[model samples]
Target: MAFDTKLKQWTSLGLGTVLMTGALAGCGEATKPADTPAAAEVSETEANSHAGGDHHGAEADAAAPATEAGEGEGGVTIEAAYTDPVVYKSAIAIAAAHVLAARDAYAEGKTEAAAEMFAHPVSEVLFDMEPVFASQGVEDFTGLFSDTSAAVFAGESQEQINARTDEILAALDKAAESAPETDMSDAMVSASVASDQIERASDMYVLSIDSDFYETYLDGYGFYKAAELTFSQNEAAIEAENANAASAIRSALALLAEAYPTALRPDSLDADASALAVAASEVQLELSQ
Candidate 1:
């Protein structure tokens, strides 16, 4: 859990810095540069005018018809509103997949991969749920969803992830209650199934690590192939006296070790034909530098 703790600490520090910077920048007298006072004043005046214009423009756009103003402009679609139930259900399913994939990635120490998986449902899938929220009179569910998603991407513990997932499901249930026409049964079931999968996968993956299951399991064959290809490339670089290429290859090998630490050690690199071929292609791209 060192990585998780470090990630959370980093996120807290980063968010604090961003907020503090914004606060300082917002304070007119505090933020002014000594040499640029006059220019800053002019810029601030123009910025205020632009902000006012933007506020009015936003109001005007909100008042406009959904089809004319919102749809086709990267805004929420009319379909999203009418199809709230289906969209909400689909988003839940996607979120579930993301949770499982992120947990798996994290277990394997693929921090960046885990972060990417953790972020997708929030940025893409959950954002699509805004229409559903509006339809249900759920005012500004964005903050809650965004915060939870941020926590997940910041490497919150699996317990926190589960709790947040439950929170989301509860919110969805509340929204469904207000919008009585939208059946939430399927969405709820899908969410439950996904949550169960994550729990089971977490246990199984942990046990596998302890038992060296990944190395013994046939599915892990690709990992060995990847390591061998990387090692071979590293050997060639060393033979050619290309220190830089060899160093890069060594870095790639290190990444592979982080990815499959237990089962795919560099010395014992062997895999079945199909898995070896696929792993070769992937490792080639991974170590292309």
Candidate 2:
């Protein structure tokens, strides 16, 4: 069987019950309007710094109105809003960082470290955003985050961990549902979706590198390893300001592009790889100038 098919089967078996519940709850509801305005613009590097991924471009404007400014005891003006896109964006960024750190730790065979990293976002970051969710009228938001954090650190089986992760994502979707209808809300929802995608993609990438899977599918493993090596070399070349680095980077990306047809990848993996390739090409162009 193809690797994607096997992956789907494995995931379905592991998450069948949770998936059923999510489907029943209408978890697939569309959060953004078809005509939503462009999101607040940020450079690719800035976005990566915030989210620790290759996500770029803006989908909808996330600027919330600063209403009811008042002077504080120290004569400092306090601009407050019941809904702020900044809060949502910050939460998403922290979540992404947590997932990335956890993946790296897991890949390094530090299971305890990975678990701690996985638990941090829910306990620290998402817990801190409880008030933001409350302001948007998302009931039980704090409880959900707390429960997910507990489950993550409980030393559960991989299947159980996957289920808990799904629950947390569903809760995030629910919070998005409660957000006030506005450009800021749309942007927040989009950001949440993007973060979720990045986390899922990272998980699948880690899985693909597992020793058993790599042994079973040498072609895919070899392709991915080669691509990673080339990409790293390109980075080093760029850092050294080599005149031929741009061409080398382009060649590396082209080699990575060949994996799409030769390897069996999940949809999320394919999408992320394509995005990275495009981003690398853009970087190569910039270096050539």
Report the lDDT tens digits of candidate 1 across residue range 141-238.
43344455456446678677657655754554455445424454443322222222222222222223333322222112222222233235236434
The residue-level lDDT of candidate 1 at 259 comes to: 39
Question: Which sections of candidate 2 miss by over 4 Å?
Answer: 1-81, 84-90, 96-109, 143-154, 184-289
What candidate 1 gets wrong by more than 4 Å, as runs, is: 1-84, 144-156, 172-289
Total backbone collisions for each predicted model:
0, 4
| Worst lDDT 10-window in candidate 2 | 21-30
